[model samples]
Target chain A: MSPESEEMMWCHSCREEYDALDAGTCKECYEEASETEEELKREIEDLKSKVHFLRLSSPIESDLSPSDVSLHASSDRKGVYPPVPAHKIVLMSRSPVFRAMLGGEMEESRSGVIKIEDVSYNVLCSFVQYMYTADTLLNEQLACELLILAEKYQVKHLKFFCERFMTSRISNDNAVTNFAFAHRYNSKNLLESSLALILDNISTLTQREDYKDLVEKDPRLVVEIYEAYLSRQVNTAASVKELQNV
Target chain B: MSPESEEMMWCHSCREEYDALDAGTCKECYEEASETEEELKREIEDLKSKVHFLRLSSPIESDLSPSDVSLHASSDRKGVYPPVPAHKIVLMSRSPVFRAMLGGEMEESRSGVIKIEDVSYNVLCSFVQYMYTADTLLNEQLACELLILAEKYQVKHLKFFCERFMTSRISNDNAVTNFAFAHRYNSKNLLESSLALILDNISTLTQREDYKDLVEKDPRLVVEIYEAYLSRQVNTAASVKELQNV
Candidate 1:
């Protein structure tokens, strides 16, 4: 055989000729990997169908006959918006706060009217929809609002969902604000990531308007940020000194 | 280098040496495949969480304040079983049969009691539990019983679940019985597999008691099985003749 032929091997996957040095796996492993991929795909299909089966029709979308309770987003300036209809069982099942309020002899339980203070009408609707379906289309503003509500209701799943969305959207502009919000909400993951980003850009931290506001509104949070920055600096200095000694 | 070394290739996955013929994929493809597998796993995790979030507390398990409807499994030999508590909204959302029966002027709608005939209490509880959680532990008997109720209620997900279980458990001893059950229930996948298994064991068909019962009770099904066997034989003979001519 020629040198080229000796050096070349056919790829089982892409079916192209690749050099010996670029070889991936033995044929046995390739076949086994293919089988594993197939099994994973089948499992994905099964889980997808299970999700479809478990998803309840959002009460907001469907004309479900019995919505036992109604929720209003209380607004001081605009008065009360129309009630967002919901099932008590659904609310109770999803949130411990709702369960306590509805399961006990609370005013909300007796009147079948839940007054959710300081939430917008649209946000309230989305919240109720999520209770039924465990899904919602979210932007940054909506995610933050819903995160607060989820936190109050003790809906851990929705709170985590919102935190994930907000964390993904974090940037230099929002890192300080998000860090403060994360701290307030006990969002450890969001707090850590935002603090890391803030520390990375520590030179310009004092110049931003949000930074000044954070120092005024929550001076303790500002101190924590500085403490983290100082700790990182000490660790870096220690590493450099140890390297020099070596 | 030795000839042995010259003829060998390394598997990136298992880190083992093998011949050129045993080669699987190139390095690039292997890395890409690994990444793809990781992505698939992450997707599975996300989907599993979604399933968990969507799963509702079965009314049977929880002392939920309001259960709008109750179910009784009517048995001929035994007296009526205790009521299985459920929410109307859950029943309506899961099955169209329940939607029509409860949504309209049906007797079940007026009384808030649904009488499920020809089902045992254990099976009834399992059926309602699956309605809420989309899960159940099934033996062969339970699978068969739930499948019938699932079929009656037009709960396609549960029906498919039962069909998959029964299909996995099909054997020579039970093939004829399952074929009849699958046929009666319009289970195409189960019917096809059971029919194929029967055709594979055509010579022993008359020896089985279930086969004799099937011949006595549903002669048409027996005739259909024989027809399928003859069709397979003709196709086999045709393929043999083609090979001989070649």
Candidate 2:
């Protein structure tokens, strides 16, 4: 090797030689940064262990759940499902709506039997499982159903989880329907994301079936979309004029 | 600057010129490391939010806790203390012992009252609060008391937490007592750490008051310590002999 090339700096991390222009951090800073990374990794491990410790086993994990209360899902199509047992403390702790319902002078509180209307047995079971485990597998349909249930019971954690799931799945096909759903449930994250996707594909908006359904069901949302489009056009024109002046 | 020195590399992190000897990492490696750090930090934040969502507010934090069960600390000095209200589900979820006691046809479950003997009222309250919050302010005295309670109830999470606290505070003076305590409570982490400390200070072992007390209280533990020391000595001697042979 030439003398100049022989004097090239080497990276402690990748163990590769680099030219002067490719330098990253000095030895002291590298050591400090490595320490910081290790500390962060250790913290993540600790938090993971804590989460595992905090998570309760789902009632379905055992035949006898030792539950103090039972729930019946009263569905229109499937009829009254078998009773799902749950702990009162867990129910109350996870949702303020449940706390109020179970703590007050209500028949459900007295009887220890909560009858939830308009939800299928599967949805009800998943919701109760999420209360114990703080986790659930979600598809598009499950996310939609859970978001509504989360909103109804005021379970902010589950609501946020569902909103995040739905936001990631937002696309041209489902944007209109998701936007309407977001507005109905007051899900700000989902609403903003769906609006952005809809606005980006504004030229092809009216052709979609969900768009026609939204317009028929909620014409005010369609008007708001046009207003937003107009506002965007005006802002773009203002920026163009300012640039021309400059 | 000299031409040779002017050719030196500059660190992006510390922003200082460095020679080949002081080189740390290449630019690509540094960027990748930075991204990994950011991802880990984001994960930590997510896990923290989950923990916050899972943590239940202590019933003691409220004037009228919607508690269905109450605990009384039967203290030796003060007799029965004021009832500390708690939820059965919370207790049962945290500890298998509590689960068995509350789930079966136990008198405490039937009466909705549990008597915890051989603990102060303050300690009982703190234990219940920790069950809810997964946190507590700890001193050596409180750590010892809570460790005992955690062991009796088989609350592994709290037991590990107390063991960590006591391990951090292990020193020459407390080594003997801590070793004995760790053994009694089956805290393997604390026991190993305390034993290591005691073995390191074996030359002055008999001079400490706690060491003498341990010898009187449980001479078998002292023999075990000596056995461990002798085993360590034999290993060291073998390694030294192997080196000499080489």
| Predicted structure 2: lDDT | 0.86
lDDT of 1 at A189: 81
**Candidate 1 residue-wise lDDT, B1-246, digit = tens:** 655566578899999987666778989999999999999998899889888888889988987658889998777346655789998889998999999999999999999999889888899999999998899999999999999999899999999999999999999999999999999988998999999999988778669999999999999999999888889999999999999999
lDDT scores in order: 0.89, 0.86
In candidate 1, chain A reaches a TM of 0.92
Give me the candidate number with maximum TM-score. Answer: 1
The residue pairs in collision within model 1 are: A24-B26, A27-B22, A27-B23
Candidate 1: deviation at residue B184, Å? Answer: 0.5
Task: Tell me how large the interface RMSD of candidate 1 is.
Answer: 1.4
Candidate 2 lDDT by residue in tens digits, A42-161:
999889878877777777666333577888887834554578898777788889888888888988888899888888889889999998888999999999999999999999999999
lDDT of 1 by residue, A79-149 (tens): 65567888887899889999999999999989999999988989998998888887899999999999999
